[model samples]
Target: MKRIALLGMPNTGKSTLFNRMTGGAARVGNWPGITVELLSGKILLGGDMVEIIDLPGIYDLHGFSDDEQVVRHFLHDNVPDLALVILNATQIERQMSLLLQLKRLNLNVVVLLNMADEAKKYGITIDSKKMAEMLDMPVFLLSGKYGAGYPEALQAVARALRYPTPGMAEQLRSQLEEDAHLESEMARVLHHAVQIPVQMPEHLSDKLDRVMLHPWAGLPLFFGIMYLLFQGIFLLGQPLQLWVGDALGWLRGAALEPAVGWLPAIVQGLLLDGLYNGVATVAAFVPLIILFFLFMAMVEDSGYLSRAAFLMDALMAKMGLDGRGFVMLLMGFGCNVPALMGTRVMRSRSLRLLTMLIIPFSLCSARLQVFVFITAALFSPVAAPLVLFSLYLSSFAAAILTALLFKGKYQNNEPFVLELPPYRFPTLRQMLLRGWQEVSHFLRRATQFIVAGVVLVWLLTNLPPAAAPGGPDTFAGMIGSLLHPLFAPVGIDEQLTIALIFGFVAKEIVIGALAVIYGQFGDALGSALAQQLDWVQAYSFMLFTLIYTPCLSAIATLRNEAKSTGFAAFVIVWSLALAWLVSFLFYQTARALGY
Candidate 1:
């Protein structure tokens, strides 16, 4: 099988192109010595099996960042038969630098000027034939999103395999000297060969970007969009949540309850009561997750995220991080695992480490359930949103403050160079496919960890008290009491402390523990907790949950990425210490204010 490597800058639709080529069957693994994943897959072309490797999206090979190193090593060590350079056509000038570097490696190369449709909208044109002559390789204009002109690109790649030409060794030396001359030559060729339309289509995105990228208006617009997103999630999820809850209740009563044997009861409870119900609760948020991703995809596809980074650059700099780092932090709100992995986008080691260190403070989606369930039980509907907003706000504040304190000399200005792809209507098929992918991932996790967590909680909480006289004498009670003092300063009860302990294994398990411990409250726990605990205590719990040590998997990822066990240990201890300190301060202040 012929080996082919796909290389490009981040967010250049490399994944989309891979999915298009390999039918989304790529095996993603961490690149050697880096947490950034390397994607590999096989595709059959003209009865020949080709192994395709998708290298990490990188800007330049000169950087010492994990992603850059990954691409650099891969190219140097296991040279592929063909190097497919996917360039965002709209930003071809900047992307060409990487192409020149790859050319210097004396590898067979094919240039894919992707996002061609978007380039046209920007009054930009690329002459593939002319570009091919200049780069001394085949070049094709294509759009991965629209699936246009891909076949030609693939055929060119296949043909390149048959005729390998080596470039002159001195070409590398000349490339540095004549970069400006080469660009001018390429531009002149494009002018003669490619034609622009008399008038470009007017896009709503342009109008939106005008407002969204405004220095004074952008922040407000961002906040407004966020508020709508939260409201939309809650409104859309209520029905699905109730339906799943009712279905679980019916299944539990109808078949599970009638089982006479102990084995049957245990089996039924484990499968239906524990796994099914637990998964259903999490799955109920599918609509919301899908909607959020849909919006994100639109922004990404339309090339607005780059502009967002540009607008927020100053604010991010104030926090001692760059604009790109801000995007990773924003992603942390959706899920910390991928967000942590996304830190590969950062070019600076200190910046990436600091971002990873603080991401645990972001209010991830799993915690949203806790917020909604608890707030609804304790306070009015309006109060739930307000409380949730405050929790998210607190998390962001904490992240920024931590970054500022940890500011280091590594903070250097790297221009946020981004390609703004033209906006297009999102395809329903794509959205549904992506949504199902995430929902399936969530279901898998629930079955694997959450089911076991529920059973474990049931065993711990329902086990008979030790025959010894005191409450602390019981096995579970003793365990809870032992951990309670550590959490006491934060106003977390023994039960909540136990949940936090389980959360260290997996955050979702905290919900499972709560369900088992507080299920007797029967869906009213949220309102009940609000009434039972003061606002101050509720806020403190939320704060602690946000800043507490990440799950075991996250710690493992941190260890793997940082390449230092001591650093991982530091992350665990530091996060816990910070969580304790912050929660304690909030508790005291809130009490002093008599909340």
Candidate 2:
């Protein structure tokens, strides 16, 4: 099979193009030695199967970032027969630089000036034939979104496969002989062949960026946006959460309660109470996850995300990080696994490490259940949102402080170069598709990790203690005892400590453990806990869960990205220690205030 690679800079519609070509069947996996996932698919061309690999979006191959290195190694080692270089037509000047570098590799190359429709609106026009001659390869103008010029682009690929031109190196070297002359030649050709009208609408992005990136107004704007996003998540999710809860209760009483009666008591409890409730809790968050993704997708597609990054650059620089790192932090709100993987966008090793270390602090969707359940039960409805916001603020503050501390020791900083794509209205099809994808992922987690977690929590909490004295004497009680003292200063009881410990395996399991534990003691557990556990203790539990160890998948990804078990181990240990300390301080301070 012939091999082809799709290469481009970030957000240049590479994934869109990949989806267009492969019908979204590409297998995605982390590239060797990098956290950024690579996408690959096989396309039939001219009655022959051709493998297409979508490389990570990168600006230049000279960088040391994992993404850059991944591309560099693939180009050097696999050496694809053809490289389909996808460039954003609107940003030709900067995009062309990568194409120039790729030309030096001497691969059969085809240039795809994607997003041609948007480029034309920007008064940017590229003469395909002229570009082809300039680069000594075929050029196809494509609008992947609209499926324009797709057939021609595919034909160009097939032609390249048949002809297999190996003249790119010589062509590139020749162009370098007279840099000014070469540019003039290309410009003259473009002027004659390409006609872009001057009349166009105002770039709405520029107008928005002016205010969104303003020093004084930017921070408030960001906070407002975040507040609205969470408000929508909470408000929209509440109905669904309640509905799911009621449905689960009905199912448990009407069906599961009677169905499991013939089974042993332990087996009955594990299935009816543990597994069933765990899946229900995770399912309840589906609405919130969908809402969060919709909000992010709107921001991203509207081109505000880049402006947000630009506004954050200076603040991030104070911590030896770049504005791009902020994007990863933002992603953590949706899911930490992707957020951790997003650190590949950060070029500096130290910055990547620091960002990864702090990402767990960002309240991931998995932890939203813990927050909502606890706050809704303990605080007023109005106070619940405020309490959740405070926890989010704490996480953000902790991340910034951690970054600053790391900067003091390792001060390498990379420039945050980003392309602010022109703002446009989002298509309904795209929004719904993206939103559905996130919701599907949430449901999958419910079935895979959450279901099993519920069963385990049910078993642990229901199983009789090897020695009987108190709650701490049970199987889970014993395990909780081992880890409980570390959280004593944080006001976390043995039961909560056990939940926290299990959270490292999978965050969704925390809620399941709590459900089983609280349900096991029935009325006694709640009344006794209410008397013993003060508001400070509740606050401390929330804080600790927010900042503590990441989910198991995140740890595995860290190991893959950092390429060192030691680094992953350090991250796990460090996050646990910091969470404990921060929670302890919060509890102590709250107590001192007589809360």
Give me the candidate number with maximum TM-score.
2
Residue pairs with colliding backbones in model 1 are 377-526, 377-527, 378-526, 378-527, 378-530
Count of backbone clashes, every candidate in sequence: 5, 0
User: Per-residue alpha-carbon lDDT of model 2 for 459-535, expressed as tens digits?
Assistant: 67656735432366677787888876676777888888778877888887787667666663222333445665666
lDDT of 1 by residue, 1-595 (tens): 6778899887677877876787655565644434356668799876689888988888876666667777776766566788888988877766777777677678788888888988887787777887688667788999888889988888877788776445334322321455686577656655665665667667677787788888899988877776776776666665566565666567656876566335765565555545554555555455555565665555455565666667777888887777777777677766677778777766667777777777777787667766666665666776767777777788888888778877773354555555555555556645554455444555555567777776776556545533332134545566878888787777887777767877788777776666655543225444446555776777788788888888776787777776779878987888888889999998988778787
RMSD of 1: 4.2
**Model 1 ranges with Cα > 4 A deviation:** 31-36, 41-51, 104-108, 130-136, 151-207, 259-280, 408-425, 440-448, 464-474, 519-536, 589-595
Q: Considering summed lDDT, which 10 consecutive residues are worst modelled in model 2?
A: 167-176
> Please, what is the whole-model Cα lDDT of each candidate in the order they appear?
0.70, 0.74
C-alpha positional error of residue 309 in candidate 2 after TM-score superposition, expressed in Å: 1.7
Off by over 4 Å in 2: 1-4, 20-26, 30-36, 41-52, 61-64, 79-82, 103-110, 129-138, 146-202, 439-448, 465-470, 520-535
RMSD, one per candidate, in order = 4.2, 4.2
Error of 2 at 321 (Å): 2.0
Query: Using alpha carbons, what is the TM-score of model 1?
Result: 0.84
